[model samples]
Target: MSTYQDADAWVAMADRTRRSIVERLAHRPMAVGELAADLPVSRPAVSQHLKVLKRAGLVCDRAEGTRRVYQLEPAGLAAMRDELDRFWLRALDGFKELVEDEGDPP
Candidate 1:
C-alpha cells in the first residue's frame, strides 16, 4: 500500500534469527522461551527480535496462560509480497516498453 518507509525494515526482519523464529512458528504457535531454546539468541534477544517483527506486522502473538505465543501473520506477509510483486512487475513492464520503443534490435 502507498509506500513503506523503506524495504530495509522488512528485509531486516528477514534476518537469520527472525526467519528461524517465523519458520518455527509458521506451523504452530510457540512461546518465546521455547523458540529461544532452539535458536542461538538469548530469550531476551529472541523477545527483542520478536518485537521488531511484530512492529513490522510480520508476526502476531496471543496470550496463552501467562505466556505469549507467537505465530506468522499471513496478511502482513501477503502485503509485503504484493508490494514486491508490483515493484518487479512495473520494472519488467518498463523494460519491455524500453525494448519495444527501441525499434528492431541490432
Candidate 2:
C-alpha cells in the first residue's frame, strides 16, 4: 500500500539504467547482485539505482534470507499510465478540433 506520484515515476524512468532495471523486474523479482550481473554496471551501481527506483515508487523490495529482492510496483506504473492516457486524450482532442476548423472560412 504505497502512495505513488505519477511525476516521480516518469522522472525515475528517464534514466536508461533505471528503465532497464524496471524491464528486468517486470519479468521477475531479483536481487541486486543478479541485476548487476546481467547489466553492464557494478553491484553498488545497481544498488544505487534501486534506491532511486524505490524512492520514486516505481519499485519495492523485500528481504528474503539476507537478500533484498526488487520487483516492479504496479500501482506506480498504473498511475503513470493514467497520466499518459490523459495527455494523449488532450492532444488528440486538440488535433481533432484543429482538423475540423480547417474547413471553415477564417
Candidate 3:
C-alpha cells in the first residue's frame, strides 16, 4: 500500500486511549475485557477504539473460544516504522548536505 494509506496508522493512534490500547496489545494479545480493565474507558469504548485500529490495519483479532483476542498487526506496525525511518533518513541527509556546504571554503 502507498505511504499515504499507511499514514492512517498514525491517525488511528493519535488518540491517547487508542495509544494506550496499542501499548497494551504490544505486550500480549488481549480480549476487550482484559484491555478495558486496565484503562479508564468502558469495555464498549475499548471495542470502538479497537475497531478503528483494526480498520487502520494496526491490529487484528481472532476468536479465542468465546472471546475475541486482539494483537498488533506486524505488517502494519512495520510499515509505520519503515515510513518513520525514511523520514528520519531524509532529514539526516539534508543536514549532512547543509554541513558539507557550510564547510566549503568560499
Candidate 4:
C-alpha cells in the first residue's frame, strides 16, 4: 500500500516545473542558480519548487560552500516505481482471470 508520503511525491511531481527539475537532477545534481539558468522560472521560483520536492522526499540537498546542491532521492523514486509495478501487476492479473473465464464453458 502507498503511504501519504508516496502520495505526496506523486502530487509534487504533477507540476510541470517540478518534473523539469527532476529531469535535470537525473542528469546531475545542481544548485538553485544552476537549475534556474536552464529553466524558464526565476531562481527563487526554482527554490520554491525544490522545497516542495524535498518535502515530498523526492529530492535531497547538501550544502556545498554557500550553495545547496540538490539531487534525486533514490529510495523515494524506487518507492514510486514499486507502486506503479504493483498496479500493473494487479491489472494484468485481472486480465488473465477474464481471459481464462472466457475460455471456460457456460
Is 2 or 3 the stronger prediction by lDDT?
3
lDDT (10s digit) by residue, model 2, range 1-106: 2334566677789999999999999999999999999999999999999998888888999999999999998988887887789999999999999999997997
Kindly report which residue stretches of model 1 are placed more than 4 angstroms away from their true locations once superposed.
Answer: 1-11, 98-106
Error of 2 at 27 (Å): 0.9
Which prediction has the highest TM-score against the true structure? 3
Error of 2 at 73 (Å): 0.6
**lDDT accuracy of residue 4 in candidate 1:** 64
Q: Could you say which candidate leads in lDDT?
A: 4
For candidate 3, the per-residue lDDT at 89 reads 100
Sorting all predicted structures by TM-score, with the top scorer first, yields: 3, 4, 2, 1
- Worst lDDT run of 10 residues, candidate 4, spans 1-10
| Cα lDDT for residue 31, candidate 2 | 98
Stronger candidate by TM-score (1 vs 2): 2
Better of 1 and 4 by lDDT: 4
Compared with the true structure, what per-residue lDDT tens digits does model 1 show for residues 1-106? 2246236447746598898888898888889999999998899999999988887778889998999999987877787888889989999999999989898767
Against the reference, the lDDT scores of all candidates come to 0.83, 0.89, 0.94, 0.96
* lDDT accuracy of residue 6 in candidate 2: 60
Model 3 scores worst on lDDT over the 10 consecutive residues at 1-10
Q: What's the CA error at residue 105 for candidate 3, in Å? A: 1.3
